[model samples]
Target: MGYVMQPSRPIDWIRNAIRYTRHSPKRLDVFKKCVKAEKIDSKALLCLDIPTRWNSTYKMLDRAQKIEKAFNAFDLAHPNYRNNLRDGVPKVTDWSYARKLRNLLELFKHKTNNASATKYVTVNMFYIEMMDIYTHIRNMKGIDPESRLMADAMQNKFDKYWGTNNKGLNYILYFAAILDPQSKLGVLSFGFACVFKAEKKERDQRGT
Candidate 1:
């Protein structure tokens, strides 16, 4: 949303924190002491993120958050943790935003990974993947301000191709879905119900 940072405070502060801690052996040692004092147990230490990939950022935050107490401690123990950053130190709310974004990104990373898998791509998978995303977006619309904005942006892009208002429905996707035992007519019916209400379809199915 706001560059790679989502809301700017979440990812940007996170990026700075990791780079700050690991930039020098001395600084990292101080952070480790903070970690130890807090009794933090982690298999992985704080890691930097690449600006291009959300998953990398997610990993960075996922690791950082496990030792959130350490980070808070480091902020106090190391003066530069505040003085070095242009944006000041990470706060409770910053971590809260990070926590929410981290949770959201985890599911998205999983979806993108599944969709991006090249080992075996199938026609039926197309609809299922898209449907999952569409449903996810719809559900996320009212959850939080950031999520609503993100979901709305995504929904806009999604609608251009797959919206019911679009005249050219891709029947091949339907055919593929119908053939898949895991996702057959029910998925299509659900898709139709999303565009057009389920009540009508339910009545039609019942022939009543």
Candidate 2:
């Protein structure tokens, strides 16, 4: 739910494809044939994403990506599937974006689980997990235009809550990291430099 997902046609197609196949038994049988036609041996099948559930979206997209070929095959075999969907069938590029989006969200799902765990002292892990997500967004930005758009949107939301200028942050995460001894000030300073973009300047004429 933290993700600031831009409304997208690719996701809409994914949603519609799952609904198209799963809603009707006839469609499901035909989709199974198409799945077999594609030699997709996985037991998992496409399911719908719930808007409010973060993991559900990941499950939906991840499963859809694994069986994408069957969806493509279904598009070709069933003529009504196209006419029924307002967005029509997804093109090759649409699937490509969907793949990228799934990859992007995959990490978030894992980290979300880690943060939500109740049996451990999670505070010490906060700075590292948040920073990893920050790094991932930076890495994802240069993949392509569509990726940049997605990354940029997410970055904005990230900045809103966790940016250098934001005051709502819990400072205890820094203390927890410091108290760990393995991290201490070095990890804290590194995080500050990265988040604040405040690189160390050389004392002499040359830069550090």
Candidate 3:
């Protein structure tokens, strides 16, 4: 996989754009008015992302995408829209990248929500969920070079945690998965074989 040493451009752009918009009452008002005019859901407000939380970034992008048309109109109606912003305003390409980022982050969002469910025991499911995350990060093919760079940066972090010496492949996780009736040893065996590229016999021996 490709390596990117810089910060994720799409995320940085979104963070700056949101901060810039929130700082300007006139721009924010125009955004709200446009949302109302467009008959978008009232909850579809442009939310600012918390620097610490990935899910909040997902929410910010999702909301921003919903109001993209409004931003487009605002840019056309106000010639000074871009100039007035403290940071550079988001362009159409930035908005498109946000949509792509949102889609990719949705998988993590859903996994996080599921893990947070209080009613069910989620321990056995964690192994599968983490594997899914690893697979998703590894398989990502971004829409453009910038998006690809962002994905590569994320993948690098994921690899640090899960790859190299297969540190993430703990026996406890497999044991927990095997103990769950819904996903027994057979499932664990198959999963190990696929992820580690181990032979079926080796996977079965490991499971045993």
Displacement of the residue 7 alpha carbon in candidate 2, Å: 2.2
Which residue pairs clash within candidate 2?
A: none
Q: Weakest 10 consecutive residues, lDDT, candidate 2?
A: 198-207
What tens digits encode model 2's per-residue C-alpha lDDT throughout 119-151?
Answer: 997888887888888888878877888778877
- Candidate 3 residue 57 C-alpha distance from true site, Å: 1.7
lDDT of 1 by residue, 1-208 (tens): 2124345656687778888899999999999999999998886978887755667878888898888899889988998788888565777888888888788668667777786788986677877777776777777767978788876666666677777667787788779888999888987787767756633563597798
Candidates 2 and 3 compared by TM-score, better number: 2
In the order shown, the candidates' Cα RMSDs to the true structure are 6.2, 4.8, 6.3
Q: What is the C-alpha lDDT of each candidate?
A: 0.76, 0.80, 0.69
lDDT (10s digit) by residue, model 3, range 31-59: 67766777767576677866556687778
Off by over 4 Å in 1: 1-7, 117-123, 157-174, 195-208
What is model 1's C-alpha RMSD? 6.2
Compare candidates 2 and 3 on lDDT and give the better one: 2
